[model samples]
Target: MEAFPRAILIDLDDTLVDDSSNVDACWDDACAAVAPRLRGVGVDRLRAAIDRRASWYWSDPKRHRTGRLDLRAVRRHILELAFAELGIDDSGLARDLAEMYRQLREERAQMFPGVIDTLDRLRAQGVRLGMMTNGAADAQRAKIERFGLAAYFDHIIIEGEFGAGKPDRRVFEALLSAFDVAPGDAWAIGDHLEFDVLAPMRLGLHGIWVDVRNAGLDGRPGRPHRVVSAFTEIVETPV
Candidate 1:
């Protein structure tokens, strides 16, 4: 563990970027944006309803897989359910609200602190890098371009492009192969314990969990090779 990894496979959302952290805030903003158009519906009430429906929608593994790929449709469906719960019957309004949320999220997207510098240092050290993300191609590509991430990576695998995503061994294997680096010489880093850590560990790759929320393992199933609260820590000596 003293030596740096030969290669690295990292995740996009919530790991290097700040997208999921602002989800609720963006939802609130979207709800407020459409408040004037809602009849007899308070912004707070609508937001709460949408939040509840969204929770239910993502709780299922199947829905989560499908929903992440088509977030707009998922949001529209969640809004429709929220509308039904509130006795509002406007499909057009629901669609517009979903699109509003999507735009708000995109406009506010940002990378985690020091991510650019960390990636730069890794590249300077001759560490092979790959980005493994699960989302629609356009959405993932937009973030990569916006943050100038492509220049730092040797391989970029989006679920929409690969036709599969993380926690699926194939995606992880493909990335390691792309770098021509053995699993033991590489690390999988991300916020999601399952997709970023356990999945790659299963393939003999070191797993580094970026606990950006400062949330400890708290009896989480698998053990990560290392855990740090930020991306910058990966370059430093292991704690």
Candidate 2:
């Protein structure tokens, strides 16, 4: 165990907030809103069909690199599947649905349990906080605002805004620069192994993998510098 780093970088989705729930709700809303246009398409059935296509797009080896899926593209692919299922011949509808989902998603931002308390403790301990996420600026910003999380972060970097996504050192570099700290002086906490852990590890920073589900990595050779299942565990463990 070592002393906590001077600064902390956190991922948004599934790290601080339970975005999966928001995403599910957005899908449901989209299905209901589009139902009339879909005519005989049942909402539940449509949701299930869209989820299946989105899951495939996320898990497909050809689509994801190092198992890191781009959420924006996943949204588009899901909409495309929905349109195809309903025999809708318009490509523009896919874009429209994606945009609609983004709007709904921005409106629903729920913080995970213990996020605020942990963040408050960390800030009081004199640690700088920053956010690194892979999503569009508008949706991400809206979530931060709705959840009242924007004031705590010294820096907030969205990958889509920078024209790049995670698993890339450039994104991490941007955060480091914003914090005016070197990689060695900071730690990155994220739930995803590929994007959050391995990506920051490449830049010589400490990578703390938040494996809340306790799902073991499959044949992964090396482990993260630190692993925690809960947000409070961060303060107990050496950063």
Candidate 3:
């Protein structure tokens, strides 16, 4: 029943937005954009290979931290792998596909249910809001503008712009500094346990896992301080 935190930092992908649709659209667009350059190579095979490699590298923390699996890097590496296997050599085509996919991703972002309304209510309650995402500025900013979700936040921090990704305390620290709030005075909410919950919790912030699917990531030992099913639950719950 105590209102301990005055500000909230929210994650963009899969937390406030339905990013799965955006990702799917990007994949489709990437395949089509690269298909002509594939030159008789099986598009399905190439896409499957890229998906496998992307998932493998993305889920591995060691590979991610070692600079082997960041977003742009992963896209380029996957294209290289696919082209190498198909005996193709066209870096220009790969670059074009990457850029196309990036644009498509921003265009396809769909805000999650209750996102705008909940944010509006939170702002009305005088809660300081901030955004923390891990992607290039153009894509993230585009999504915010497309969805008209930018004005609710006091600060927006993207890892790509900051030269570091989350689960790192420095990213969260920057957000806290921008909000002029102490760690304990703010709450970090995101869908990802490692990046969104654990990272901020390590910095003594009140991390809240937004488990929309009810997967119970918070039930694990040493996770976020709290977990909720949706953003609306934050205001309703006893703080």
Candidate 4:
């Protein structure tokens, strides 16, 4: 809290952008639309099944790495598995559900409040800024462009383009080196504790966790150097 770091590496989703906040609502909308056609499977049941499969799918680091690149396919696969669990054999319906969720999710995507102002302030203060996000190149780039975020970052690294993502110390090392800042003089901020916090902290960068949901660490491994509830907190006038 003494002074801003010389450089900061930020995450895109849930940290700068409000991407994950509407997930449950979007899933509800998608499930409700297809519930009637799912034999006796109600909306709640279908949603639960899909949620379970999705959790399991992403729980594995290997699948999470591969699945994040092709999220549409991941959704479709989750829907298919859910349908199968409920005795439904319609791949077309599963695809439809996946598409619906995608559309609904995109419709509601927006950056978190004060993100642009915070980034602008940091930049104005001569702080080097960068963004490191994981996902397909095109998909990640689209979000960057859509949110007009490209102007704020000096370096933008997408996992698909970078050949790897967070939890990989190489990514953090490369970005800090790009900014010509020592790890201890830079900060890495993101929502994922392991990827954004632990990984960077291990390499000597100050790791700041954005707890958007106000979710406590809940005994998660590796405490962040700083924990904040919003992006704007990063630039709040030091007390």
Candidate RMSDs in Å, in order, are 1.2, 3.9, 3.5, 1.3
Which candidate should be chosen as best, given lDDT against the real structure? 1
Candidate lDDT (C-alpha), each: 0.90, 0.78, 0.78, 0.89
Q: Residues 168-204, candidate 1: write the lDDT tens digits.
A: 9999999988888889999999999999899999999
- Lowest summed lDDT window (length 10), candidate 2: 61-70
lDDT by residue for model 4 (50-105), tens: 88999999999899999999999999999888888988989989888889999999
Residue 235 lDDT, candidate 3, scale 0-100: 69
Candidate 3, which segments miss by more than 4 Å at Cα?
A: 1-4, 21-25, 32-37, 59-73, 90-93, 177-180, 212-215, 218-221
**Candidate 1: stretches off by over 4 Å:** none
Predicted structure 3, TM vs. truth: 0.78
Best-to-worst TM-score order: 1, 4, 3, 2
Which is the winner by lDDT between candidate 2 and candidate 3? 2
Candidate 3 residue lDDT tens string, 111-193: 77778888988887788998988876776777788888889888888776777778778888988898788998999999888
Model 1 poorest ten-residue lDDT run: 1-10
lDDT of 3 at 193: 80
Kindly report which residue pairs in candidate 4 clash with one another.
none
